[model samples]
Target: DMTMVLRVIIRNRLSENLRHRFLLNEPVDVILMFGQIMQRNSFTLMCSSLRAHHCPDDVNNPVKEVCPQDTDSRDGFIFARDIPDRSTQSYRVQFRSLILEKKLGDALAIHDKIVSKDKRLIDRSAYNILIWGCGKYGYSRKAYELYTKMKESQLAPSNVTYTSLFNSFANSPYKSESLKLCEKVLRDVKKFDINLNYINYHAMIKAYGRCGDILMAFDLVDEMMSKKIPVNSETISFLLQGCLSQTESGFILAIMIWGKMKQYRIPRIIQHYNLLLRITKSCGVKEAASLHVFLMKNPTFFLPISLLDTESNASENTSKLLPITKKSRDDSAFSNYDSPEKRYNGLGGLDGLLAMMKKDKIKPDIKFFTNILELVPDCDTSENEILNAMSINKVQPDDVFLCMLMKKRCSYNNYEGAKEVLKLFNEYNVKLNVLVYGILATTCRTANDAKMYLESLDSNEIRLNVQILGCMLNNACRSLDYQYIIYLMKQYKIHKITPSKQCLKSLANAHKRGRQIELDIDNNVDVPKKLRQRIKRISYKHFVMSYRPWIKLVRNSEADPWEQFTVKYEDD
Candidate 1:
């Protein structure tokens, strides 16, 4: 019946008239006719139908092939099979074709039927199909579910399964669930004895990094090292990229990774240079320079081609029966080259370095200049040295470099010198930001001149921020100006500035002091209750009036005998 139905379907596809007459005439009626044909003598009709319409070509025709001459007689049948079992192979191909066509349900049905008919036919390919199918249909749950079933069915998961599962989870929507799956794999690593190679580790690291879990990525690296798995250039490169997203820790981790690379004899690649360049820029130019010096000292460790080229060439020539003289010439040429400088010069230094780089045929890009600009000046000599280095290297200083120089000058309290730097920024047309004002405000605070500090605040060219307010409040408090305190509170309320605790305390103290002065000036004749209570609450020693002066004056004035005076000491 299966053969007959398959033949009818094929015939319908081959001829439009046949399809219209039998299959498409009336969907329900055609189905009824086919059912009647199948219900009556179905197996015999299937064989006859297949023989007539679906007979194989000569290559696959079993009738044309000769049977084995030697036949072993069983109880009721003769058996002499020369061909190895191809049942699983036929089912596998069919399953793959179904999967390719995106007919997952049909593929699953066929797979189950094949496995039921011949349990021995359930192989790795079969499991892979099911897993891949489940993944394709957005059925990660089903895919994992099938993996458990495969394990229970005593089928071993191939590397392909592991790779697919990892990739599936790499961008999975359910990140928490995906991480759980990753943990499961790690826990069962020993049981499966799955060797997580470089690719596996890289994928896992990338996945964890994408999820913003830098610690997990680092842990994976440690796991690889503990297992004695040799880290390759790509692996280290990937780890470094992940580290770049971290804050300060990225630089420290990058240095550690680079050290590991050197320890493992893994030669530095272009990516390694780029990563180190970025790390140095973020960490500081000094750190970058230190790394560069280390690289220069161990040139052979990093420049593998230069180190092994002579030997490689010699072996090649020897294999061809050539003389060894050519190898020496090659070695001498490579050995005479100067080691590439690793020290990071600031932007100006980079310009000089760029000239040298050009001489060496290395075309530097904008990123190279940016890296130099970001280096924090570590000492007094750093700026000039960086400038000299750039000039010597013939690197052209850009606008960004000028801005960075100005920032450095401002940071070091060299505002007088910063004028020239600021001039450069203007010359380069660099837009000024609020940070420039912050720098100026901070400088004013250091100068400790309230006039200059206030003048800086009045500038319309630069925007004032909370830090400026804080500086003003601090200056006012130190000067103990009651009028300034009142002015600041009014300004704060009008401008919607949030007063800090220090500002609030300073305002309250100023108010208390003002009230005490008012009370002192008023005659000792019964003061207003509100004014008396305010003066009483003035605990600050400087604000509290000495009762001895008031008592002596009161007694001298011949106050009533029933009137009492009380004195209490308050800590400052």
Candidate 2:
């Protein structure tokens, strides 16, 4: 309401002939102060600071304050001028600042205000600035809209604008729409006969890579090489990110892509190496573990000796000092994790990452530990390393880990492991929240075991939630327990709790097997009619929860955590 009122006042008082004109017969100082306040407060320009630009070479530093240059005063516009008229260029700098700071809403509002006040204020430079901001900020649709708007305003989008448009897809979460927008941008570029540059080609390659068209991305890379533009670190990083977006399914492809970097002779950085670890995470635990060993053995891959490896006898007498892992007991043969291309010689997933961190003497931080607790839950070695690293850092176990560890462990029916993790949490004084206590109940493999756990816990300390309720139903999953699954579906009316997709999926699995189970009633029974009804009703309810009158999901905009938690509460 205040913003609307302010806009109305500005429109009424600020004349279209804004050449030193003032309304209300106010003093010059008051008029200037009001103008400053409107621009600063209303448009939010006061809170921005100029930083890096998307295309570093294209940006020019702002000059000192100067008098306003008329948008069209017969002088031809210089797109690459270093000393721009301050009144116009200052705003451009401010807009770029907001963009770099990721204040897209503020930047958009300011751009619209400038356009409304004087369309002439929006020259090709300003349009490019706005387009670039929208593209960088995951607003691909908005970026596309602004691109069309530029054409309608008789302002042709230059190569920079096209590059920004391509970037709109590169970072976009909406891959399909971004690809469509990219196609439109390509058509416009061809239609305009605008010559392409290295930067433009790179941006298009990244866009295609991120949008899951790695073949297209590869073609562009080939084109860049054909045109004598060397494949650089940035290009390799973009391809790595593309592989990451596809998850473990792209592991072989990633190896082939890594060969390209090797082919071009680009040295691997911490970022690229880190990306490799994340991509390898999906390639079975055994393969990933071997990769870790390979990376640690290689001196060329940044050899700061591990804190453990410091002992002279650590390598030679390692078997005597260390306990055997499951991998060693089962299959002792050495193997390589590679695709058709043997270029990516040794790339491990989470296990390799831990080894790399140990070698670098980089004590893994709490954020890294917490993120991987989800990513590589079954890695016992990683868990032990995380604890040791925390001990070295002297950081306490986070309260979240208490609850979260239970959820992940219980999902796998690792009851003993869940109990051990909770004990570790207790040693560090982690609070026993409802999430922890409830999920702990489900950790027990059998309903009788779960009932015993529930019986043993103190009533005052254990409060039940959807997660707890899910646990109570012991919604026995991933194994042959079905009592909790059927029981949970029936109890929704008596208990107010959100339905989880994990539980829903478990129910689907049970339906597939048509397995009958022993209910607490001491007789075997099949879950048929009630299960079907609840599935239909809850499925519709969950849909309503994910979709609504408001634009995006509440998981993002409205801080609706309950819905978010239940949506992705469990991995399986």
Candidate 3:
């Protein structure tokens, strides 16, 4: 009965379409209809008749031959898939995947293909994706160009569009240009009656804050407040950071503004507290200590929600809900009777805070320890606290923690202590990276010791990046080792690394110190041809020439010239 009803509806609709075209004196060429049962004879007959009106030969054409195959299983990478003219969602999915994978070239090509294939499916949302992708990957210029194309296409940019573009510009070198664009977007918001939100203001405020225009930043904050947009903690932190390098007046201004934010009940985060400590660092050690002490004493502000409630309630819930068993069989089971004092008897300050977390069954991560260590001066006490946390498995010992500990020790000229820390890393089975080696190299007492470490790195076949190579070059130059410098240049050639200007300059200094005036122009790939030729002309005398003077002063008059040059050069 339903099939009969559907057939009747199709027949009537087809009749009405034909009548409408005839009445309008318009020619109808092709008509395509979609339904569940295309195999039905009635549907096939109707389609064939409709085709016969325009092409008599198509009356006998098979429906299967005319229709394309179902392409439902062809999902692939962005540029790998054939363009589907009917499915815009497929295109969007592929494009988003390419963006996520940072395949910018493929994403752009697919975007262009999508535009050319189906203009109707290309909306403001599609343009927003392209723009956001470009912005996120540091192509703020290309993002602006995409915005221009969007405008030319008569598509009004959304608030999300403005936010993405503003964020990219804020992070770029063109912060000044971003400010002007921010103003223009504000004007557009007013003209087009688009909703303005915190994201729109965040970039503008941050740009102004970064440029040290604290007044403008505050003015924007006022503007946001006047419009009833909430000024969040991140905005306040940026304002505080902007005031860092200024004089006492700027510090006073920052304090006044912070007080105002507190009065307004703007919620603060850990970063805000950390920024306060950083600001006070410039004032004096005493001020910074006082700030930390004040923050620690007021534990309620920084405490997590789980710690805010009475410990008895949490313990009671855990004790009742957990399955009770023999203590021997369930050694890892929670003990409801544990006291806060028993848990944190020796820990204080940040350690005490971490102990509180442990008692609350909260896990403290490496970042938590890193933040505390950065603020605290006593590495010995902090290291003990971290080890305690590790003993309870509240925090896992990792390379990051080891690196931080070693760095603190090295900073205080405790190289032996730092090396001991590395041994702890090995005990923990933590793999060391080049950064750890670089930091250890910094603690070397003499240039030869540094060179020895570098040689160890090379012997291990560690991949030498520019940073490690620069460190090696610095030590070699300091030792006035011209032979070592030539070896480093050879290393650069082997690695196919174009030596940076700084590295070359260090090499020049090494040459000057070693009295090797003339540059070796042949078979060296590190120095540019022009630079080498110029240096050769300037430092006209070579180290071989120096050997001639030394030989004239001390060599036997009858000695062979070549052997004398070789011996004197080696001795020198």
Candidate 4:
């Protein structure tokens, strides 16, 4: 019935050609309306069938043929023009895309258009997007530009906005520009009722420190403290770094910051302790010991008394143990507890740390161990004290700390101590990584011990890296060990380690000394294309000046030129 009625309507209404092309079924819109009116229990089925029958074919449909250019103005407006809601969403999408793409100019233009059209729609979310984008792309000017625009549009900046701006300027190449921005932001903090949070102050301090303006960083901290802004871990860390080069002033400032933190009961983070450790290490273990004793006596000034107190009763009885007046606790901690001689005798530097460890019963971590090791060079502590610390705690030194010790020993050419460290690693069952091998190799090279060099290579514990290879090549050339040169080339091939400029230079010199002229040519031939030209230039110079004259003398004698050249080179 459905097909019969539609077919009859189509045949009666138009010419045969038109009937074939024009759809004479109920109009699609009409079918939809009819389905709704009939409550076609199967609405989905009816709609699918209707769509299928009335679907436009490109060859026959007039609507499909009608392009945008052919549409009348009203029809165009109804079908193709953007609605306000759609336009808003599209603008947001495009703005985000531009911001992500780091197309700052495009983003700014779009942002401006959106604001101009509807100022009320701009929110913190939108502002954050722009601020973060600007910082990440290193576009400080655009970031400032956006800030000024946001303010002009009456969108109040939040603390986050200020933080982002501060961070952007802090990381920018123009250090003065960052400082100027920080000053301006700080000045405006109260006017805008913005809380200059720890992050903002930290960024400013770090920026100052990084630019080598330690005094400025100190002044900024003083300004913050004077303003009653709290000192935090970041603030203390920044001050500590600046103090490294200027020991006295830096230590004073660090102690002052620590005092402030303690007064406020801010828990000292690990970094804070590390900084204190470094200061003590620099001053010498004896001084560090005295400082430690002073800190322990004045626990309330450096650490929370609660951390030092083992039992709950100690905390409850804190007032009973000490005079317990707030002002006395603050002022009396750093005051002279005893005469200098008495204090130094009572608490030797490393002994002070040992006493603290015993009192607290807290095992020192790796950083703590390293700090002690660093202080060793400055301490009068005997080797027994050093060995005892390692033996008791079973603390294994990492490659970096071990390497530092190796370098110290090598400076004095103390090969015995260097050998002892390798023995210690073996005794402890510590697996030697590539770095450890490199350090050993370097030490051996510095001592010019070829036997040790070969021994290091024979060790299964260490793998060879580029640095090790370089050290080997350097030693081989300096000692004129031609056989070692052949061994290095074979090892390089087996390990697939590429030689660096220094390594190649040393190898070439070694080859010339060994009179392995053919091997030297082969090595040069295999050099990377870019480096080959440079090596050739250097090799040519050395050959003409050093080898050519020797060659001429040998040839002038009754000796065969090539054989004499080989003999003279080998003898050297």
Q: Report lDDT (CA) for all predictions.
A: 0.51, 0.54, 0.53, 0.53
TM-score of 3: 0.55
lDDT of 1 at 196: 74
lDDT of 1 by residue, 431-455 (tens): 6665555545534432245446556
Q: Model 4: how far is 337 from its true place, Å?
A: 20
Cα RMSD (angstroms) for every candidate in the order listed: 24.1, 14.6, 18.9, 19.8
Q: Is candidate 1 or candidate 3 better by TM-score?
A: 3
CA displacement after TM-score superposition, residue 33 of candidate 2 (Å): 7.6
Error of 1 at 408 (Å): 23
| Candidate 1 backbone collisions, by pair | 292-342, 348-390, 349-390, 351-395, 352-390, 352-393, 352-394, 352-395, 353-393
Candidate 1, lDDT over the whole model: 0.51
lDDT (Cα, 0-100) at 260 in candidate 1: 50
Model 1 TM-score? 0.33
Candidate 3 segments whose C-alpha is farther than 4 A from its true place: 1-87, 112-121, 173-187, 190-193, 207-214, 237-257, 275-398, 411-413, 426-429, 443-461, 474-493, 497-572
When sorted by lDDT, best at the front, the candidate numbers are: 2, 3, 4, 1
lDDT of 3 at 119: 48
Ranking of models by TM-score: 3, 2, 4, 1
The digit string of per-residue lDDT tens for model 2 on 1-572 reads 43334435656665554423323322222223343434333222211111111122433553322223312211122111222322355456566876787666666765674565434456778778877886766677778877887898888778898888888878777888788877778777778888788899889988987887765676677677777787777777777777766643455445445444433566555566556555655432233334345435753332112212333322321222222233432223223333311212243334555565565455555555555565554555756765676677665678776566667766766667777876776688766666566666665566566556756664565644567655554355454344544444444534445556565555456544432321311352445555434434543344234323311221233333212112211111
Among all windows of 10 consecutive residues in model 2, the one with the lowest summed lDDT is 45-54
Using all chains and alpha carbons, the TM-scores for the candidates as numbered come to 0.33, 0.51, 0.55, 0.43
